[model samples]
Target: MAAQFDKIAIWLVAFIPMPVAQGLGDCFHGDDRDFSSAPDEQRFRVRSDIVVSGFLAGDPQETDFHQCGETVKLDCATGEVLARETAGTDGMSFHHFNVGNTFPDPEGGVVDNPNEFCVNFLYDGAATNPLGPPGSPDVDMNVFFTIDPIGRMLSFRGATNAFPDYEAYASVEDGPPVVLFQQKHTLDPINGLPGGADQGVSATVAI
Candidate 1:
């Protein structure tokens, strides 16, 4: 999937509550769901640090079915994810992605901020969705993570160009938390027709 796109920019964003997929069962049920009591157990409830907003990526979006949504495996002691040649990626190193180049480096054309991290998904690109037709234009999305000096907040939004016929969903992590990310667009632009329309929402929540 990464091979098709020259680059993918990713970032952290907010979420809203959603319904569970049919037959998902109790696999995602957290033990200490009550907020007034155990809070640590709820940390796992985030399900994913990375939320995909496009058609979709790979299959098995769930975390081994043990947890809902997808998670980037962390090296627990160091809190770093490995850059390697993984399956379904066709062997591209995460370290080699063309990322963060578009970010503004100088303040008043002078200095660097040095605090921003990689929003790892594509800010502008049409990705290949697994469910899309063979060699087809699958997903179009954009994510800007505090690039502007005035606003240092995460922003994830997109106008997906695809032919799914059904509405385009902000391809979120598989088996997400109680909430899900979604966006709606008209059938014209994506389907090569007329009368374009797009709809989306964002929220800032305190944990």
Candidate 2:
């Protein structure tokens, strides 16, 4: 009976279709930008750099490819927005942004310190609809974030769906240096509805 079950499993595996190959957009990095001259000098200084690359299948003729969600940094205690930036239009599949010194903690107030903060990326399919029909497939959209602290530097990378739900919590002194919280729901090829994986990690860095 066990052998029969194994044979059946092998047969089912043979029928499973492979995931389609998707195109990644033009990649970008924040290192190229000099934020010292930004309007908000105090907050615009570069501290954390993020590089992103991915693709969303959209109407090539229109500017739908130019549309993407916003990324934000917030105070963990007060929930106030510290800084925000949009995924710029590069006419390609890739996007990138830098969270510079612009991510400051509450001043002399009772607000939490800079280390107690969180970063988020909001990706809505509705915003991308202008590029393609509803329920159209969007390939892998991902982000790579790096931070420079007093003693060391750390990095993290995560993959997102067409409609991404991403968040990152600052590390506590006693805990890991970075933690990523993700909730991504993507279109199912069979039903055309949202369904996908939910992954989270608390990453510690020694260097």
Candidate 3:
């Protein structure tokens, strides 16, 4: 069954608490499109130093809650998660999230924060779900980060497969603790629609 955009918006504004897709779409549509003036693969380099991190959190709207309510066993060391619960008839489930451990950096190490780690799951070009097509049950995971002026970790959020699994998005080597992983938009591309331009990425860091 295909998930409708309106239903997803309801879940985002009412049920689920996190950054909603509609808001993101709005932000991207208003930002500048061409990062560099040069056409075709133009590079826009901005020199800046900051620490960043985050994780994934959320299930498809079409997921089956009944089947997802069960507990799924998994290894704590690696990020690999094995299903301990069955997917509901809708083929979707919600998972809880947590932060990862902290890592040690040099006195003044520069951590590059990409404007956005954009993932494009174009459903229009194919006959299946763009993020995780049919036969691929794994949820589409991601990490979003925000850093403070002093380069301290400010906030982090992302997705996971299990409801209560805290180790789903942590780094193998110890890193900083993450905040909450709430439901969010997996993949959306702005196409200069009537209301606004196609949704994209834009970020600003405070010094």
Candidate 4:
């Protein structure tokens, strides 16, 4: 019985020392290996945007697009014009259309240059008669606009069926009309409307 007790004591001493050494080593250093010594990882993420390219063609089915005698105003800031253009047609027309006008640089002062601008007359076949017969001739609409060098619409006048025609110019003798505006062109020797008569004497009609 004494020899059996001695063997049991030896076994316990041997087994206990192995687990204690392992526990001390584990507490000093973690179980995970040094993976940071390897090459660094390169991660990436991507995003996309949806873009619409062209004008909104006129739609006769919708009531907003079919409305007659409409006027629209556009406001542009120091930011992008595309966003401003989308906001401009909010209350005016259902169909979005673009006109020929260059955005004035926002940095430029008001008096630096009169921002060049023009407006479009949108007719989607609803505007056929103007208090007259259905067979009336098609006449171009006139647009009066005031602009700043900051690309802002200060004021404007627009009419659908009643006008002085497309080529009508304000006259001092003719008196003022319902809309307050004027049109005048400054002729310059160096610069004039493109494709105008080069000089006079040598000009010939084209075929």
Window of ten residues with lowest summed lDDT in model 2: 6-15
lDDT of 3 by residue, 12-102 (tens): 1001111121222121111112222111211111111111222222121222111122223333344234433333323222222212222
lDDT rank order: 2, 1, 3, 4
lDDT of 4 by residue, 20-78 (tens): 11111121111122111111111100001111111122111111121222111112232
Which candidate should be chosen as best, given lDDT against the real structure?
Answer: 2
- Clashes found in each candidate (C-alpha, N, C closer than 3 A): 13, 6, 19, 0
RMSD, one per candidate, in order:
16.8, 22.6, 21.3, 40.2
By how many angstroms RMSD does model 1 differ from the true structure?
16.8
The whole-model C-alpha lDDT of candidate 2 against the native structure comes to: 0.27
lDDT of 4 at 66: 17
Give per-residue CA lDDT, model 2, range 1-207, as digits (tens).
011000000000000011121113211111212212221222211112222212111111101123343334444445455555543333223222333333322222332212311121222221222222355433233333333332233444444342333233333332332334433334332333234322322343422
Model 3 segments beyond 4 Å from truth? 1-134, 149-151, 162-164, 168-207
Between which residue pairs do clashes occur in model 2? Answer: 25-93, 25-94, 26-93, 26-94, 43-102, 45-101
The TM-scores of all predictions, comma-separated, are 0.28, 0.24, 0.19, 0.18
Candidate 3 overall lDDT versus native = 0.22
State the number of backbone clashes in model 4: 0
**What Cα-based lDDT does every candidate model obtain?**
0.25, 0.27, 0.22, 0.20
Any idea how many clashes model 1 has? Answer: 13
Model 1 lDDT-worst window of ten: 21-30
Query: Which regions of candidate 1 are displaced past 4 Å?
Result: 1-102, 105-126, 129-133, 147-152, 155-159, 162-182, 188-207
Instruction: Please give the lDDT score at residue 52 for candidate 4.
Output: 16
